[model samples]
Every structure is written in C-alpha cells, then in structure tokens.
Target: MKQITKAVIPAAGLGTRFLPAIKACPKEMLPIVDKPTIQYIIEDSGIKDILIISGHNKRSIEDHFDRNPELELNLEEHGKADLLEQVKAIADINIHYIRQKEPKGLGHAILCAKSFVGDEPFAVLLGDDVVYNDENPCLKQLIDVYNTYGGSVLGCQTVPQEKVSSYGIVASEATAAERIFKVNDMVEKPAVDEAPSRLAVLGRYVITPEIFSILERTEPGRGGEIQLTDALKVLAKQQNMYAYDFIGRRYDVGDKQGYLEATVEYALRREDLKDNFLEYLKKVVK
Candidate 1:
C-alpha cells in the first residue's frame, strides 16, 4: 500500500444550524468539551499533513491551529505546564488551509484540495462526525483494509433499519470480524425496501485519487449540488470498494440533538467534570 500521509477535512459549510454561535465561529470549532470538534477528528486520524478546506467565514478554524503565544504564557504562569505543552503541540501538525469560494457542497469542498492531494490516495474526514474508539483509531483501521485490498475503503457502521434513509448504505459480504466487509454496492439514502444492507457509511473514507476525475464529471444531484456519494458510486463501478464496519461510536454533530448529546457525553468523560457532572445529573434525574 502507498503511504497515506495526507488527510482532507472539509469544514466549508455555512453551519446554518447553530446560527448565532456559528456566526463568528465555524461549527468545526465548536467545543465538544475542552477540545474543538475538529481537533478530535484530527487527533483521531493521526495524519500529520492535513488540508483543511474552509469557507469565507471560517478563518477562525484555521487560526486555531496556529500559535497563540499569549495563551501559552497564561497557561504557564498558572503552573499548568502540561496544558501549555498541549497548546504548543497544535503547531507541530502540518495544516494547510484552502478556501471554498462558494457553498457548493462536500464534493466541491473536496475538489478544492485536488492540488494539495496531487496524485496520492488521501483520507477524507467529515468534521461533523466524531468517532470514538477505545482500541484502534477508526481511520487507521480503514487504512489497514486499504493496504490489504488496494482500493477505496469506506468506514461503516450498523444502524437500525428505520434510519437507513439518512445514510449511504452498503451491501457487502462479511469477510472477517464485524469490523470488515467486501462491499458489493453502495446506495445513497435508500428507502427500506430499496436498501442494500444495514452498513451505513459513517463520514470516514480512504479513497484513491481516481475519485477526482469521477467527482469532476459528476453533475449536481439532490439540492442542486454535486453529491460525493454519486461520485463514489461511479468509482465503485470501475474499481473495487470495500466498507469496514469500523469499531467506534460516531456522534453526528451536524444535528442539534446529536451535538448536544456529544457535548454531554464527552463532558461526562472528562476527569475535570465527571464527578460533579455525574452527581448533578443524578440529582436532576431523581
């Protein structure tokens, strides 16, 4: 397998859901706990070179990765050197930012990174989907399958039948543990009767560069925007595509309810807030 050294994170959406909060801040910069949602995706991917595709209103998202000398000094003065080191490490990762001139769609945002990705296979991570894994990193698991299979890999997870229409469903034969599958076909937001399989694409993918050509030729679909799934469908016809039932709990921060759930769940896991937060939750529920 070729060394997968680059990752593309598409954060160009207008984030109209969180209006006022997102008016000045990018949704990807929204805090899950102490860390921004995008940071979690970046850390989880473990890739050093990241191309962050942003929009006109999302410059703060890029600045977050840059050095903040004053913030570091404040942390050090408070005897929080550990926290200071964490802030310093943000600059250690190579982050490249490019603007999506228009609010086209996910496909357009990804197309903006074509130059940065060049001819190499790259990983695409949707900033809204936060995957939690206690063992292996979700992206690494997909990369492993890509190495063995030498094709595109989409990270998938089983969802209830009723929720199939909200995702890109995959039909595949189980080839290993619940974590892997040999995909036969992909259907975007298929109805229950038309659904391929329960394995839903969960916003993580390792795709070959061949996808660029397919995406370029793809016309606007639903919402009058180019759909990435459509491009993947075309690519699947010409090359092998596998879906790995990645072992992780994914939180869709794109929705209001899911965003709140992720914030509460992640906050409860933090040592700084766990004890008091759990106690407060118990009292409230009682």
Candidate 2:
C-alpha cells in the first residue's frame, strides 16, 4: 500500500448558489463556526501536503492560509492568545495552490493538480461537503481501506430511495463489517428506476494515479461538465473499486438549507454554545 501523502481539494467553482456572499469570498472560505470549511477538511485529513485548485476570484482562499502576522499580533495584544495561536496554526500545514483557468468541472479542477500529485495515489476531497464523524476521520478511514485493498476507494452513505437520483449511485457487494463494499458499477444522478443502489458517493475519495488518464479521456457528461463520476466508471472497469459507508454526518453546504443546518449543528457542538443553543431551540420549538 502506498502512503497517500498528497491530497487535492477542488475549490474553483463559481458558487452561484450563495451569490452575494460568495461574490467577494470563495464558498470554501465560508465559516462553519469559527473555522473555514476548507480548514475542517484539512484538519480532518491530517495529511501533510494539500493541493488546492482555485479559480481567478479565489486568491483570497490561498491568502487565508498564508501567515497573517499583523492580525496575530493584534489578537495577542488584545489578550486573545488562544485566538492568535489558532490563526497562526493555519500556516502550519503545507498547502499549494493551482488555478483552474476555466470552470470546466470537478474533473478539470483535479487535473490541475497532476504535477503536484505526480504518479502517486492521492486523496480528493470536495471542499463543499463537510463530514462530522466522532469515531474516525472520514478521509483517514478511506486511506486505511485503500492501504488494505490497494485500489480506489470512495466514501459513500446510504440515502433514501427518493433521493437516489441526486447522487452517484453505486452497485456493490458487501465485503466487510464496517459497511465497506466492493463496487461493481456506478451511475451518476440516475433516475430512481435507473439507480444501481441506495448507496450514494459522498465527498471523500482515495484514487490511484490511473484516474488522471481516464479523466483526460472521459468526455463531458451532465451540465456540459467533465464529471469525475464518468472517469471513475471507466476506472472501475480496469481496476478494483470499493465504497466505504463512512460513519459520519455529512452536511451539503452547497444548498441553502443544508448550510443553515450545518451552521446550527456545528454551533450546537461547541461547548460555549451547546447548552444555550439547545435551550433556545427548545423554547423556539415549544
């Protein structure tokens, strides 16, 4: 099993959903609570080097990770040592940024990191999806499965039948106690009748270098975009592919409701906000 040292994060999307707010700020920079969404993914993965593929208007995302000495000094001088340390730690992780010249799609954004990832197996984490797992870090779990199986691993979860068409559905055979399945087929946003299974691919992925070639050859699919799901389907034909039902609560922040839900859930988890927020929720519900 190769040590998956590098990870790719595609943050180049235009994020038209939260237009006004995203006009000046990248969606990936949106805060879950006190930390930006991308920071959560980075901290969760615990990987050393992360390649963030951004677009023209996303330079602020890169700058957010860079050292902010003046801000840190101000925080420290204000007797906010904890906040200062927290901000300073953003620079601790090794991060590299690459620009996606065009909004081709997820696959294209990933292609921008080819040189950074080289020929080694790397992890791809969608910046918009946040997985809240208490038992194990979602990415780390997928990496462990990749180490044991030495193949592509996708993070998946069981969704209701009505929602199958909204995700990349997988047809798989049970292979482990942890809900890890050997994937036989995958379908992207298939209609209810066409879906392979109820298990939908989530945001986490551990893919081999072979995907780069497949992605290059894959034609644009839905929405005139080079869908990563299309490339994965091709890769599955050549090599073994597996899906792990990652243990976590995933928040799809791309949608308005999901974003609000994530904010409330994350805020409620914080010690400072938990009790009061829960009490407020009780009052509001009553």
Candidate 3:
C-alpha cells in the first residue's frame, strides 16, 4: 500500500450558487469570519504539497496562498505581529495550482491533477464543504481507513432519507468498526424514493490511483459533467471501498443557509466571542 502524501482540491466549480459576489471573487476565497474557506480546507487536509484545480475566475485562490510581502511589511511597521503571522501562514504552505481550462466536473478537476499525484493514493477535499474536527480531521481519518483497507474510503454520514437526492449515496453493509461500512455500490443523486440508503457521501475521499484511469473513460454524467460519483462506482465494483461515518460538524459553506449557520456555530466556539456572542444571540432570539 502506498502512503497518501498528496491532496487534490477540486476548486474549479463556477460557484453559481453564490453568484454576483462570486462573479468577481472566487467562492473558495470567501472567508469564514477570519480565514477563507479554502484555508479551512487546507488546515483539515492533513496533507501538504496540494494541487488545487482552479478555473476561470479562481486566480484569487493562487494569490491568497502566495507571499504578500508589502502587506507583511505594513503589518510589521504597525507592530501587528499576530495578524502578520496569520497572513504569512498561508504563503508558506507548499501549494501548486493548475487551471481546469473548462468547468468540467469534480471528477474532471481531480483528473487534472494526474501528473502531480503520479501513482500515490491521494485525498480529495471539495471546497464547498468544510468539516471541522480539531481532534480528527475528516480527510486525515479517511487516510487512516485507506492505510488499513489499501483501496478507497468515502467519507460519509447518514442523512435523512428525504435528503438523499442531494448527494451520492451508498448501498452498504456495516463493518465491525462502529461507524464504518463496506460500500457495495454507489448511486449518484437518486430520487428520494429510488435511493438505496441514506449513507450520503460527504465529499472527502481518499482515492486510489486506479481512479485516474476510471475517470478518463467516464462520460459526462448528471448535469453533463464528469461526476466523481460515477468513477468511484466503478472502483467499488473492482475492489473493496469503505464509507466512514466520520466525526465532525460539517458545514456546507457554499449554500447561504448552511454558511450562515456555520458562521454562527463557529463564532460560538471562539473563546473571545462565546460569552458575548451567546448573550447577543439570546437577546436577538427573544
């Protein structure tokens, strides 16, 4: 089994969900209070030397991670050492970028990292969803499963059966490990009535190198894009793939409601804001 050393972040989506604001600024660069959403993705990635698949207006993702010496010097002059460190932290990460050329799909964006990933098993973190778990990052937990299974592991969690239509779901059988299950099949965004189970894939994947070839042959699927779900389906049939009901509070930061909820929750968790923010919330809700 190969060690998972690299990560592929499929950040090429047009982010039409947050349009206008996203028209000028890339959605991945949208901040969750203090840090951009992509920064949270990187912090939870647990793997350095990332290859970010970008497209169209996503240059901000690259610029955000590059050194801003002028900004640094200005902060230094003002003696804002703590703020300066936060700015420098991203610049120091080993990040590489590539444009997807077209807004293909999640699978296509990942395929764009073929040369960078080479033959190693790599983790994929979608920019839309941010899983917060300081004790065990979602992607890192998936890596542990890959190390044990030597195939692929889909980071999943049970969603309401009615909501299964929004995500790719698994046909699975439970394994001895509490929340883990062996994936027998994958169904991409099926109708609620047609869904096999509620084990919805949560977009954190530790995929084997074999998937690059599988994705190459996959035609554009749901929404005329080369869906990652299709490629993973093939991999499951060929070898064992597991779906881990990972530990975390997942925030779908791409959606307005989810983003607002995540912001409030994340803010509540902050030491500086907990007391004041909680009091403010109590007053507002009354």
Candidate 4:
C-alpha cells in the first residue's frame, strides 16, 4: 500500500442549515473559537497536500489559506510577531482548490477530486464534522487502519439510536482488534427503525482509488443527489472495508446545537479562556 500523503476535503455544500449567516460567509469558515472549522480538518489530516472541493460563495475558504502580504506587513508593523507567525503558518499549508460547479452532493464533490488524488489512497475529511482528539487525529486513526488492513477504512463512532437516521449507519461484525469492525453493509440515513446498527459513519475516511469507478456508475439516490454512501456500499461488496471506532468527540458543526456545543467545549479547553468561561457557564446554569 502507498503512504497516504494526499487528502480531499469536500467543502462545496451551500450550508443551507446556517441560512442568513452563511449567506455571506461560508459555513466551513465559521469559527469554532478563534480558528475556522475547515482549518481543523486540514490540520487533523496531518498532510500537506490537500484538495479543497469548493463551491459558489466559498472564496473566503481559499483566501483564508492563501498568502496575505498586506496582513503580514500590518502585523509586522504592529510588532505582533506571534500573530504574524500564526497567519503565515496557515498560508504555508499546501492547499489546492477546485469548484464543484454544481451543488450535486457529497459524492459528486468527492468525484471532483479524482484528478488531484490520482491513483493513491486518499483521506477525505468533511467540513461539517470536526473530530477532537488530544492524542491522535481522527483522519490519522483511519489511515492507520488502512495501513494495517490494506482497504478502505472509515472513522466511526457509535451515536444514539434515535440519531441513526442522521448518518450513514453501518452493519459490521467485530474484529480481533479492539475498536475495529469488518463492515458488512451500509445504509445511508436509514430510518431509526430501519437502521442496521448505531455505529454511524462520521466524516473521516481513508478510501482506496477503486472508489472512483464505483462512483462513476452510481446513480443519484436520496434526494436525487449522488450519495457517497451509495457508492461505498458497492465498494464494500467488491472488497473488504473496515470501520474503526475512532477515539474522539465529534461535533456536527453543521447543526446549530452541535455548533454551540463545540464552541463551548473548545472555548473551555483553552487555557486563556477556561477559568472565566467555566465560571460564566456555572453562573448561567445557576
């Protein structure tokens, strides 16, 4: 197997959930605390070469990572070296952008990156889902599984039975290794009663190149959009695919409640804001 050096981030969604706020700013650019949500995805991928699948009104995502000489000069003039370094570091990341051209769906957005990914196994991190892990990044954990197993690996976490309809739930049997499962089947956002299991597939994935061909012939499903889940199901039948119960707290930042929870938790984790934020939280609850 080849080393997973490339990553694809499907950020082309219009973010209808965010509505008025997202009308001007891309939801992927929404800040969790001080950093944009998409930045977390890029950093967690632990790779330099990344392709960002973007769409209309998503120019801010590109600008955020591109060099800003004026801003750098301003920070220098103000003697804010630390802030300058932080801004410069973001531009240093090797990011490539491609327009989805249409709001087809996740599968279409991913298919757009096929040229960039070439023949190598690549990681896909969704902009809406942010996984927080102090020790290992979620994408890295999936890549580790791909390295060991030589097949597609999904980073999954068990969600509540009631929430199974919100994700691509997988039916799988446990493997000999801890926190690993051999995926038998996948259902895209099945009704709670119809769901196979509570093991919902999150945004992180390490997929082999064979998926592109599978996606090519995949007809649009569920809302008349080409669903990645639909393609993955076909791939699962052709070869062994595994799901790793990744260690992390995943926040579906696309949802209003999940965004607030992520913001509060991320704020509480910061040393500069923890004490004051915790006190304020306590006061509010009381």
Candidate 5:
C-alpha cells in the first residue's frame, strides 16, 4: 500500500458549547496558549496535503495560515526575527479548505472531501483532539498499524468505564503487543451498562477509501445527522478494523474542562515556563 500522504480535518461545527465566546470564532482556531488547536494537530500530522472542512465563521482559519506580507514586514522591521519566521512558517503549510455550508455531522464533513481524497487512503483528524508525542506521533502510529494490517486503524485510549457512554467503545482481542488490538466490534457512545469495553475511540484515524461507500449509506443516527461512527460500524463488519491504544495525552478541546487542561498541561510542558508555572499552580492550589 502507498503511504497515506493526505489528511482531512473537520472544523465546521457551530461550537454552540462555547456559545458567544466562539460566536464569531472558529473553535479550531481557539488558542492553546499561543498556538491554535488546529495548528498543533497539523504541525504533527506528517501530511503535506491537508484539507480542512470548514463552516460558518471559519474565515479566521484561512487568514491565520495565509501569507501576510504587511505583518511579516512589520515583524521584520521591528527586529522580531523569531516572530517573522513563525508567521512565514504558517504561510508555508500546504492546507486547503472547503465550506460545509451546514452543521450536519462529522460524516458529512468528511464526505465533502471525497474529491480531494480521490482513491487514496487518507487520515481524519478532528481539530478538537490535541495529542502530544514526539517519538511516535499519534497519527503515525495509526498509519503504522494500517500498513501492517492493511486495514483502517482508529486511535483509541482507555477511558474510565463510567465515561464509556460518552465515546465509541471497542471490543477486541489483544495482539502480541499489549496496546494493539484486533478489533471485533465497535459501538458508538454505548451506555455504560451496554458498553463492550472501556476502550474509547479518540479523534484520530487512518481510513481506507472504501469507507466512503459505507458512509454514503449510513443513516442519521444519534443527532439526526450522519455519523462517522455509524459508517465505521459498518466498515468494521466488512473489513478488518484495528484500534491501536495510542501512546499520548489526548485533550478534548470541545469541552470547556478538557480545553483548560490541555492549555495548562501544554504550557507546563514548555521548558521556560515549567518552573514558574509550577510555582504559580502550587500557590493557586494552596
């Protein structure tokens, strides 16, 4: 199989959870400290060609990545070489966008990328997920499994059993590697009492092209919208889908609490701030 060189990021949601704060802003553009969540995802995506599915109020995403010679000139004239280079770097990233036009669902957003994807296997990265891993990027891990198994691979993590209902759960037999599993079944947001296991699907995936056909037939499920989970369920039945328990800390930026945790944890990880931030946090807790 060819290396998956393309990625699709769905950022078209209305972000009602954040309400007025995100009223005119794209949630994907929300900053984690100095960087936007989407930038973090793409920075490590290992993909050169990226297609972002955007919806209402998503113009900022385009502007952020677009080259601004005026701003660059300003930063350069001010002797801010570091800042000037940073803006230039953002401009160099190969990312394109398509309008979703409506807040349908993840499945719908992905479908809009069919033309961009063509017949190649591509990655689906939700902007809400921010995973930190240097040695083995989360998406690279999934792609490794895809190359080995010749099937779709979903990024998964062990969530609390009680939180199983909040995510898609997987049932599988353990492989030689403890974290790799040969997935037998998957249920989207199954009730705790009905969940197959505590293994919850995270927002990263390297999917085969066949998924487009399955998604086309998948009906509106949970929110009266086409769901990626529903299509994956059918794909699971027809093909070999594996869930690799990826090694990384995943933050759900779509939730207020998760977003704050990502911000603090990420900021704490920076070398210059760790000591000071640690002292500040200690004082706040006290």
Candidate 6:
C-alpha cells in the first residue's frame, strides 16, 4: 500500500453563517487565538505535502502559508526574533493550492485535487472541523488505521441523538479491535428518528484514489451539489471501508457556537494565556 503523505483540505465554503465576519475574509482564515483555523487543520494532519482546495475570495489562505519577506525583514528590524521564527515557520512547509472555480460542494472541492493526489491514497482534512489530540493528531489516527487495514478509513466520533441530523451518520458492525467498525451504510443529514446510528463521520478521512472515480460519476444530491457522503456510500458498497472512532476532542469550528467554544478552550490550553484567561472567565461569570 502507498504511504499516506498527501492531504487535501477543502476551504471553498462561502461561510454564510459567518456573514459580515467572512464578507471579505475567508472563514478558514479566522484565527483561533493567533493562528488561522486552517493552520490548525494543516498541523493536525501531520502531512507536509498538502494541497489546499480553495475557491473565490480565498487567496488569503494561500498568502498565509506563503513567505512574507517584507514582514520578516520588518520583524528582524524590530528585534522580534521569537515572533519572526513563528512567522517564518508558517511558510516553511511545502503547501500548494488549486481554486475550485465554483462554490461546489465538498465533493467537488476534493475532486479538484485529483491531479495533485495522483495515485496515492491521500488524507482529507476539512477546515470546518478541527480535532485536537496532543499525543495523536486526528488525521494521523485515521492514517494509522488506513495503514493497518489497507483500505479507506473514516474518522468518526459519536454525537448526540439530536445532533445526528447535522452530520453524516454511519451504520457499522463492530470489529474485534476496539473503536473500529466495518461501515455498512451512511446517511447524510438524516432526520433524528431515521438515523442509522450516532457514529457521525467527522472531517478527517483517509480515502483511496478509487473514490475519485466514484465522485466523478456521483450526481449532485441534497443542495444540488455533489455530496461526498453520496460517493462514500457507493464506495462502501464496492470496497472494504471502515470507520474508526478516533481519540480526540472535535470542535465544529464552522458553527458560531462551536467556534466560540473552540476559541475559549484553545485559549485555556495555552500556558501563557490560561491563567489570565481563566481568571477573566471567572470574573465574567460572577
């Protein structure tokens, strides 16, 4: 099997929920504390050869990862050595981008990366969801499962019954190994009562190249856009697809409430900000 080295990040969403905040800025560029949310997704993926699938008004995502010589020089002139290193490190890795001409669905965004992905099994990390695990990054967990099983693996986490309608729900049969399931079926945004299971497919995916063919033939579903879930269902029928309940705390940073929670929780995790932030939070609550 090919080693999972390449990753595709779909950042083309219009982010209608963010409205004015995202009017001129890409939602993926929204900073959680100091780093862009997409940066967190990139780092979490543990893959340096990344191809970001971007769309209109998303040039900032590219600029964020590109070298800023003028800014670096200014930082040097100001004697901000530590800060300079951080800024430089952001552009130190190999990152590339391809624009998805239209605001197509996530499936189309991923389909744009076919040439970049070639024949290798690549991981897909959506900027909307950021999974945190210091010991094992979420994408790494999925890749490990893919390596072990020699097939596609989806990163899954259990969601509340009420929340099942918001995610692609999976029905699976348990494997002998813990937290791994042979996915039998998946329904995209099913009604609460009709959901097959609460095992929601999260943003992390380790998909084989065969999916590209499946996606190409998949007709647009739901909102008249090619749905990845639709293609995944077809893929599941043809191949051995497994879902692994990855160990991590997932934040749906795409949603307003989830975004705020991620920001606060992430701030608390920082050694330099935790004490002051926590004290401020305590004061505000009272």
lDDT of all predictions, in order shown?
0.89, 0.90, 0.90, 0.93, 0.90, 0.92
| TM-score result, candidate 3 | 0.97
> Candidate 4 — what's its lDDT?
0.93
Compare candidates 2 and 4 on lDDT and give the better one.
4
The candidate, 1 or 5, that scores higher on TM-score is 5
The predictions' CA RMSDs to the true structure, in order, are 1.5, 1.3, 1.1, 0.8, 1.2, 0.8
Give the alpha carbon lDDT tens digit for every residue of 123-156 in model 1. 9999889998868899999999898888899999
Write one digit per residue (lDDT tens) for candidate 4, span 1-286.
7999999999888889999999999999999999999998888779999999988999998899999999999999999999999999999999999999988888999999999999999999988899999898888888888889989998899999999999999999999999999999999999989999999999989998999998899899999999999999999999999999999899999999999999999999999999999999999999
Higher lDDT: candidate 1 or 3? 3
Q: Residue 118 of model 1: what lDDT?
A: 89
Candidate 1 lDDT (Cα, 0 to 1): 0.89
Cα error, candidate 6, residue 147 (Å): 0.9
Q: What RMSD value applies to candidate 4?
A: 0.8
lDDT of 6 by residue, 1-286 (tens): 9999999998888999999999999999999999999999988777889998888899898888999999999999999999999999899879998999987698998899999999999999888898889998888888888989978999999999999999999999999999999998999999999999999998989999999999899898989999999999999999999999999899999999999999999999999999999999999999
Give the runs in model 5 whose Cα sits over 4 Å from its true position. none
- How high is the lDDT of residue 108 in model 5? 84
Give per-residue CA lDDT, model 3, range 65-116, as digits (tens).
9999999999999999999999998888899999899877888998999999
Regions more than 4 Å wrong, model 3: none
Per-residue lDDT, model 6, residue 257, is 95
Clashes of each: 0, 0, 0, 0, 0, 0
- Runs in model 4 lying further than 4 Å from the true structure: none
In candidate 2, residue 65 scores what lDDT? 90
TM-score of each: 0.95, 0.96, 0.97, 0.98, 0.97, 0.98
Measured on C-alpha atoms, candidate 2 has an lDDT of: 0.90
- Distance from true location, Cα of 106 in model 2, Å: 1.0
